[model samples]
Every structure is written in C-alpha cells, then in structure tokens.
Target: MEIIVVIGGPLEEGAIRRWLHQKLQQKDNQKFQFIGVDGGCLKLMSEELPIDLAIGDFDSISSGDKEILKNYAAKMIEFPSEKDFTDFEEALMWVAKSYPQQKIHVLGAFGGRVDHAISCLWTMFRPELQALIPYLSLEDEWNHISFLTPGEYVIHKLEHTKYLSFISTGSVKQLTLKQVKYPLNHQDYDFPIALISNEFIDEQMEISFESGGIIVGQTRDSWR
Candidate 1:
C-alpha cells in the first residue's frame, strides 16, 4: 500500500507538479490513497488531483473551498483550531495509527516558514511513528528524506545530486559511512551534521550506527 499525504506547505517547482500528476495517475495496480491536510486539500483540488480524505482545522482554506472539499472528499474531518497538534501532525498521527504497515510518502512538507519546515522534519520522531521511520519520508521536488534507526542500511544514491546529508537532532554513537566521498567510522557527534557535498562512490552506500537515529536527506542544490 502506498499513502501519499499532502500538507499545507510551499510547492513551487513545476517538476514537482508534473511528478505528482504522474503519481496520481499510477494507482491502477496498487492500494493507493491520497490525503490532504488543511490547505493541502485546496492545493490538490487546484491541481485537479483526487483527494481521498481531508483532515485539519481547515482555518487556512476559504469557506467556498471547504464546501467544495466536503463534496469532493470521501471524508472531511475537522478539529478545533486550538488543538495541541498542528494540522500535519494530526494527519501524520492518523497515518501512523491507521497504516502502520503501509509505505507513507509525504509531500508539501517543506518550503515554508523555517519553523514549519523544522516541524515537518521533527514530526518523524514522534514516539508512535518512530517504529515506522523506515517506511516514511518527507519529499519535495529535490529532496527525499527518511529517518533512520540504529541499524545498517544500504541506501541507494539519488541521481538528483551527489549530496547526502545526515542530520541528528540528538547524539549519534559509532556512526559509520561507507562508499561515499568522505567516509566516517565510529564517530560521535552531539549536533546535526549535514555531511554535505558527499558523492556516492558506488551504486550503494552503507550507513550504520550503534545508537540514536538520524534523518538522511538525499537532495540537490540546483532545485533550491
């Protein structure tokens, strides 16, 4: 199963638009679902994509658009604007609960206010969703990000760029990187390290760590 969830964030690239359209059209052979959170519903409607479910307080959408959503969406769930979680957080929690075994692709999760972008990335660390980290990613036009647990992962390089960044909000123990331009072995870091401009020497790169987790961003500079 593939679940694509669109959040209310900036999505400006024309390529991203085309890619999403292609994805929306390829649901013929699998269990696919499209969910729009808050203004994401408006964006999907504007882009002429089918939205299976809409979730959020919806304060960001106009009443007219909300009416249209009510008619077009298979389900529309509204929460109070004063809730503890943000719209995307609520939507992600729902995904974590409902589709624990499904692969989740998140779009429109970045390119917004700096804090919002941070929130989008940090949401992957939520306790309930932490176990599903390997099956989720926050994607945009040029970036594919996934949170990694304490294990050895053979990650394939993205053709978009030779850049791969490893970010740890907390400490990482005995982190090792192989088959990359700059390799690290048994390293300890207390802060986030971008490990920027690192090229993959082989088709596959192996990353491992003893403790803690990190978010790996496979991205390109040209897209920003």
Candidate 2:
C-alpha cells in the first residue's frame, strides 16, 4: 500500500480531485493509507475522503474540526504542540518507522511560509528519513516533486506537465540528460544548481547521474 501524507499548505480542491481521480484509475487495485496532519485532516474530511491515519498536534485545528477528524479517521495520534519537529515531519517519521517500504506521496506541503516550504523539501534528507528518499514525493496543483538517486532513469512526461527541471541536492557528477530540448553530456555540477525549464522532445526523456542526488520537478504554468 502507498501512503499519502496531507499537510496544511495551499490546496486547490479541483486540482486535488483531478489528481486523485487519475491515480485511482491508474492503480485500480492499489490500496492507499491516507495520513492527515493537523488541519490537513480537515482537508481530507472536506473532500469526503477516508482518513486511514490522522496524526498531528491538533493546535492548528479547532475542537469541532478535531471531533470531525476523530469520527472519520480510522486511527489517530496526537502530539504536543511544543515539539522538536513540525507536525509534517512527525508524520513522516512515523511513516518511516511503521511503513518504511511503502512509497509516501505528500500533498499540501508547498506554499504558505517560505521556511516551511524549504523545511518540507529538506526533511526528506533527515537521518531517519534518508532511506525513504527515492520513495518520497510531493505534489500540488502546479508541481510534482521527486528525488532521484544515482542511476539511469527513463522519465515519462506526466500529463499536462509542460516543463521538467532538476536541482542538485548535493555535489553531482557525470550527469547526462537525453532526448530533451536542452540535452547535456556528462556534465559535472560541484554545487547545487537548477537546470530549469527543460522540455521533453518526445513522450519520455533519459536522466543519468553517477554521484549525488537530484530533485526532479514536473511542472505546469497553470491548472488549465
């Protein structure tokens, strides 16, 4: 089963519904465990989606909202508001310990505070969650973010994704991109840089790197 972690970030109901619809169709037999964090649980409830596990501090939600989450959620875990990690990070840590093998897709993790956005992106590299790097991803109305380890990958263009981008999370070497508008040949990047706005030449593209990791983003200008 794949796990979906919902946090309190910018959410477009229409975009979320469409994304969920496509995912359901693609994985007809797949089971999903939805983990709602704080106000994120409210979003799942508002959408009339099942909350398999609701985990958070509940400080961001009202009593009524907490009641709603409790009634609908299959399992719920609460933490102190004054804690070391953010609610989102707590949820990720729980998943890492409980369902380490399952791929975790995060929603509502972008927008809002710049620090929170950056924290969410860097949280994947935490010592506890580093093993889940390749299995982790984040998505919103306009962007889908994923991490890549050192390997050759055939990336199929996501529907309506107009641009492809790569950002080095650390020092990278022997990076190559093929079948894309701006192809690269064994390029070495010593520091973090963004290779942004690359377009697909066909239905798919190739990415290969010998060392370090990269953040891959498939994005669009608008929902339309």
Q: What is the C-alpha lDDT of each candidate?
A: 0.82, 0.87
Cα deviation in Å at residue 3, candidate 2?
A: 1.6
**lDDT (tens digit, per residue) of candidate 1 on 30-102:** 6668899998887778777788999999999889889989999998889999988888888888888888878
Candidate 2, residues 153-198: lDDT per residue as tens digits? Answer: 9989988579999998889999999999999999998899899999
Q: Return the TM-score for candidate 2, rounded to 2 decimals.
A: 0.91
- In model 2, which range of ten residues has the least summed lDDT? 13-22
Candidate 2: residue pairs that collide = none
> Quick one: best lDDT, which candidate?
2
TM-score of each: 0.91, 0.91
Q: What is the lDDT of residue 192 in candidate 2?
A: 92
For model 1, what is the alpha-carbon lDDT of residue 56?
96
lDDT of 2 at 71: 84
Ten-residue stretch with the least lDDT total in model 1: 13-22
